[model samples]
Target: MFQGRLVQGYDFVDGDTDPSEVGAPYVNPAYGHGTHVSGIIALVAPEARIMPIRVLDENGEGDFWRIAEAIVWAANHGADVVNISFGYPQQTQLLRDLLDACSDGTTTTGKTFPEIGINRLFFSIAAGNSGDSTFIYPAADADDSNGSLAIGASTRFDRLAQFSTFHNRVKLVAPGENIVSAIPGDRYAFWSGTSMAAPIVSAVAALVKARYPNLNPVEIAERVEQTSVRISYGNPQIRINRVDALCAVTLIPPATCNP
Candidate 1:
């Protein structure tokens, strides 16, 4: 109802980029799922710009190609942090190639564009909404140590959500369940699952980028992981603190002076 008025959305294209044609119905009558997630990210980093990339359709299905294009576009368009709040069940090597290609600091389109010179384009994707222990697509797609970041879900109790799939692939964990954020029509909603968790990390990443503009995507992730507050979850340990992202931006000179 409030697409352009209070909120903005993106068109997830199946083929290549197009200026027109974007229509997809939501599985849930509520069409604010992506808006809600994007809002949370903006909330944490109120100063950071939010880019709406609609990879998934109204039915909640997105192909690998669409996702790849979104990543490339965000990089080309000067987005410091790209948050992917959803994942699929299938694996695609082509997607992995795209992610790696983007992080390598080259234009995948092969058509030369003016240099944006953004230090790094980090991809922060949800670990997966499934409660199962198995790995999820895209998140699991980090078969190698690519520059992308895969985040898991944690509750306010600081416990891992049963539905959030976890593995070594998950770089960090954050609040996911019942998270309150913006939605379509300027409404606010509380959502669950790893989907909610991914954006929290994205917001933090934005904070990091804003503070330490020189740090690249990989450096930002390293700082977040290294400075994170560690927690335990039975057999597997998780990171709860999103690395004091605000501090990363606010407090860099002191560390550098001492170093």
Candidate 2:
């Protein structure tokens, strides 16, 4: 469990940094999931500050109310970029409205997300590792023309990973297969999933935001997507923009991202 760090959790998490470590007779299986995602973000953007907000237990089950609460907290607490490497297949209106608030500055009902010193937040969401063209909530919002970036897993060869969900909902792809990042017990591990691809895009959004401070949250996300390397393997119409940090920061045109 990651102790001595800024961690806030729901009631189900108790006081333990990792909810998986709280129960006595049983520990949550994904003990280092949060740290692992945070490590990827840190690895990509070392200077960016991160706030670890726990909304789900180790079993990957979460309440949409709590998740919405956490998103509101981060938006008001100086967090301009949020990386959610988790999602469910079920679609709900609660998260859909909240995700819109992150980029629209207000909800459809006119409720505000209350930003700190920058534009509304940007969300990097996992496109699920189901290996099929299935829909994952929140990330499924990628098709809604918002600041949320739905990222899928890609192999080292830049080809879509077998386990990655490729479809119109997936807006981008990144290195998710055999990804190495920090795990629990002060160690590291190699894991592969669309979950691993999301944070990489989050950090790239941070870099782009840092490079162009004036860009809005939607604009920052757009810049990254606009400069990504198109794999040319996905559908001819549905773009599968692969995230490129250097190209995003340099504002390289997507047309010139040829290998």
Candidate 1: deviation at residue 38, Å?
0.8
Output the TM-score of candidate 1: 0.79
Candidate with best lDDT: 2
TM-score attained by model 2? 0.86
> Worst 10-residue stretch by lDDT in candidate 1?
1-10
How do all models score by TM-score?
A: 0.79, 0.86
Give the whole-model CA lDDT for all candidates, comma-separated.
Answer: 0.66, 0.77
Writing each residue's lDDT as its tens digit, candidate 1 over 215-237 gives 77667666665555555576644
Backbone clash pairs for candidate 2 read: 20-28
Error of 1 at 203 (Å): 0.9
- In model 2, the Cα lDDT at residue 168 comes to 80
